[model samples]
Target: MALAATVAGAPVHAQDSDWLSYRDAYRGMVAFEKYGKPKQFLQQHYQVGARDGSPLPVDFRLALSGKTMQLNLPLDAVGRAVFPLLKAAYDENAVLTVNRKLGAYVFRPRISIVVRPDGVYEGAELRAACEQALDFQRTVNAAGYRDKHCVGVRFTFAKKPDADVRWKGGAPLPAVPGPAFPDEAGNAYSVVTVRFDAATDKGQVVSQNAPLAVSPVFE
Candidate 1:
């Protein structure tokens, strides 16, 4: 599988059962959900295009503060890495717009993480990696998302290897790379499987998803 090419530490074949669960769990979490009300400061629509104006699929990473959420849409691979950082920064400056009449804040925190080239691979490790990345992005951004005084709170993504990597409590194939393709939306994406480790944060890292939008895409 494509994930094997990305995992650098272990041999491809190691565990089995564990990898299977990982694959099943990962696939179960791909649907999109509405988060909350939108903000006026964020862009209404993000334009995701390649350097040459080619339409690229956009994957998003999100971070949330008390009532504010930050959305990031990376236009390229390099931008993908920096997208989380940008969300962190934006969440820092977001102010709560309160509504006296409603006795509540006018803005509701919400974010959506999407990727182009959907279903590039089918396995446990890739799903775990995506979840981990999302969790980290959300937690780190939370520092800025919430009030400046917010403290003593910690966030982390769960660490679990893909099913192909573990079976019957034994490690299976290290990780395999999978086919590359674009989703019906016409965007390219790739999936890689990797073992999950709380230490060094290595094992499985896949190609970044398309740009993600944290806007109130819903009403």
Candidate 2:
């Protein structure tokens, strides 16, 4: 599986009784709902793209202030790793960072999505103006970024990875070599990531349906 190529540290395998799959479990979540509990946080994904809906090297660590550290898996690979829970304490107003290795250096690019009473966020505009400082380092990267390891980091929206960002929903995300997310500044960043205001999601329901079908869409 493509995700098997990307997972780190843990060997997540699907068995007759156990496996980790995110997109299927999430998409069919509606079929399993028996109770609805109000939640401040919801589960969503960081569907990056070489364009807008792609995945990155399986090695990058998408850290959310240690509250959640993700390896931005493709929808088909969520079982390998998932931030199954999103809490207001863990996500709201927290600074999110992407820590990855390029040869001998570690680059930490950051952003914060603080939910305001007015529902506004710092980098919702996704411009260099929205780029956060790299507390992990004080030096510009080999790429020559001044303060942050990135400048052109940007974002666009799409249907949730649960449905749209899949190998079958459209173009199969290539494990191609290039900046994972295209830079508006056109710099060749070694890694890029996406963020969601978990506290503002549509929330989940109790599933009553059979287990989700985790096969690759075109399989």
**How high is the CA lDDT of each candidate model?**
0.24, 0.26
For 35-81, candidate 1 gives per-residue lDDT tens digits of 23322122211121232222332342222222345333233331122
Model 2, 1-219: lDDT tens digits are 122211211122222221223432232222212213321222223322222223445554444433344434323221112333334423333333334321212111212222223322233332222232222112223122333333322222222222211111224222222332232122232221322234213321111111111110000
Taking all chains together, each candidate's TM-score versus the true structure is 0.18, 0.21
Task: Judge candidate 1 at residue 3 and give its lDDT.
Answer: 22
Q: Which candidate is the best by lDDT?
A: 2
In terms of lDDT, the poorest run of 10 residues in model 1 is 150-159
* Residue 182 displacement (Å), model 2: 19
- Record all residue pairs in model 2 with backbone atoms less than 3 Å apart, i.e. clashing: 20-79, 21-79, 32-206, 32-207, 32-208, 33-206, 48-54, 49-54
